[model samples]
Target: MDITHRGPALPLAMMLALAACSEPLDFDLRGRMGGSVDTSQAALAAVADRPKPDDRGIISYPNYQVAVARRGDTLATLAGRVGLPAGEVARYNGIQTDDGLRAGEIIALPRRVSEPSPATGAAATGPIRPAASVDITTLASGAIDRAPATPATRTTTGTTAPAAQTGVEPVRHKVARGETAYTIARLYNVSPRSLADWNSLDKDFTLREGQFLLIPVVETAPANAVAVTTAPGTGSPTPQPPSASAPLPKDEPSPAAMAAAATEQKKEPVADIGQSQPAKSSAAMAMPVGGSIIREYSKGKNDGIDISAAAGTAVKAAAGGTVAAITENTDGVQIVVIRHPDDLLSIYTHVDGLKVKKGDAVSRGQTIGGVRAGSPSFLHFEVRKGFDSVDPMKYLQ
Candidate 1:
């Protein structure tokens, strides 16, 4: 028998044989379609919601859009995943195509590719049937005709009512460099677990720089909430009222007593010639470094005083306190934060060769580090009460 004459039967036999095999082959007998499937809808569906980002890491805001990178993602990889050209994505973000992205780094989109979708959850893969082969409009109309929908409602004025508001909107916080989930929670007075849940943090509660986090809703404001008072490097003229620190232990001498004992007094009767006067002591706080003030505190300008000092100059603690946190800014410069009495915090920046670590007890004028070397070596000193930045000069004396 000539197989060419039985083409239809041969295909049927082949299909049956394939189905009977241990693993059936998944082949489309329709052959390739002449027209390409449009993927534009899929791209738009990926970021349908406004303001709130989608699971694909796309943030669809009204004015602009952005994307958050996943672990081990590069600009090129992110571009492919977000359906934008790699060059455009890289140029928009001011990074190279192959730049490795921090897990939560923000990648700005140059242009809007899709409008926000009100729909949520997974997006559709593609059109159910290829547009080239089917008359979808005719099929949809037929299906609609067969469907039964004989219900109607009307208001007194014959208008539909608007939907009520849903849950409360949360405050969005951008994770800065050196910020941890715990520190952020503490700053907002929310439990770490709550923050993690709100942000979908991993088991380790890890946070990445530039990642957006939604602050949990609470009945009351946090006790120590950090106000968006002013950007760092801009000083606020009006200092926040200071809160009192915990009372010192009963056995320890008060700061005043320590100060008084530090200064030597003239004995009423001169001691024997061989005897020496008490060694002179200093106050509870002093200048961290002795240098000319290159920049004074200015509200909305300089957040701290810039003291021009020589490189390697010893940086001292301004008061008796414990190191609250040791962090670095985006520039990688080291910052030392010390918590002192009276709810005071002193920040020392641009310092290197740290001698003390976080949580270490430091006394007044103790050496903590040295000034970092630069073209114009200076120590950036800041005094903060609670979460508000204040003039360091007010407390430096």
Candidate 2:
């Protein structure tokens, strides 16, 4: 055979050489695929190497916090909620005159760390002891003593036998280390003046630690009547008249019972008169009134103050009480009377609508009605000692 006839073997030789180059191409493809797989690992590793951001906001300072007052939240209630006394809260917030906190008002409550006791001279340490508990008891003495016989000639038919006046029992309190006269007075529901008077100390005097002081009790009574007897020869005993003395009825009501009965009666205003009675603090009378003073308390004509607002503006119960009366007078002014504890009554006049029905127990600063339309839109607030109207400003904040 000729050498030219060996072309098939030459072609086979060329195919073998191409197969050797394909092995290298296969290695390059495997490397590229491995490189692609390594890229995903690098991406995941890059994500894992990134830093995270802290989420906490600006840190707040110690002993400083904010409080939001909700609707119907009084200063007292707010203080109680925040573990503080109302007086301290008021003083801290620089609230001197008004306690009428508007809804959504933000109040600041400053925390104070307790200091070392001066007496002990110990270093300032440990948790602060809470204030001492104060118990308020009605200070009236119910004990009846012997009444000296009055002259028989000067007696009235309607007047019953006088009961001996009961002496007021003093409340005993132990002074704390940091206690002051004002603090004690506030805690005991007594006035600082009254507290001083009971202890016979100067108003500015400081109370010593472990000192014992007396707190005069608060009492509410009907009209205080003292018997004025004429001497034997003077004025003939005001013309003695022979009047039959009826035997004491077995079922007769006591003075308190009669007063309660009268309170239940719709017509008459209850009377609460006593000289030693402490007036309610203005801080305690924090009724909200969005109005101007149309008239102030006057000695003659207008006895109580008048607050002028738009018609239908709310008129709240000045203090806690029951709805005593709801009537329209000849002057076309609607009036609602609320009888409080201890025989006190508050009257609201010129109301357009009454929200509380008769005998409904309303709390202090409760909405009872609104001002009448076409009327002066004024609330004629009166504090009555029986039928006589006393000054409402004397007891308001």
Off by over 4 Å in 2: 1-282
Alpha-carbon TM-score of each model against the true structure: 0.36, 0.30
Candidate 1 residue lDDT tens string, 1-397: 4556867888788779768954224242221233342221221221111233455666554345567778999989988877899997776555689988767555667776554332422232111121111122221222211111221234469874221111223456767888876667656656555666555566667666756676665543434444667788898766432321122223333555434323311112122233333223444357888799877786434556788899998888776776766776444577777767665667788889998886666666667899988778888887766545577777765
Backbone clashes, candidate 1: 3
- In model 2, how large is the Cα lDDT of residue 158? 59
lDDT of 2 by residue, 158-180 (tens): 55433212122334566777776
Give the clash total for candidate 2: 0
List per-prediction Cα lDDT, in the order shown.
Answer: 0.57, 0.46
In model 1, the Cα lDDT at residue 117 comes to: 38
Model 1 lDDT on a 0 to 1 scale: 0.57
Give me the candidate number with maximum lDDT. Answer: 1
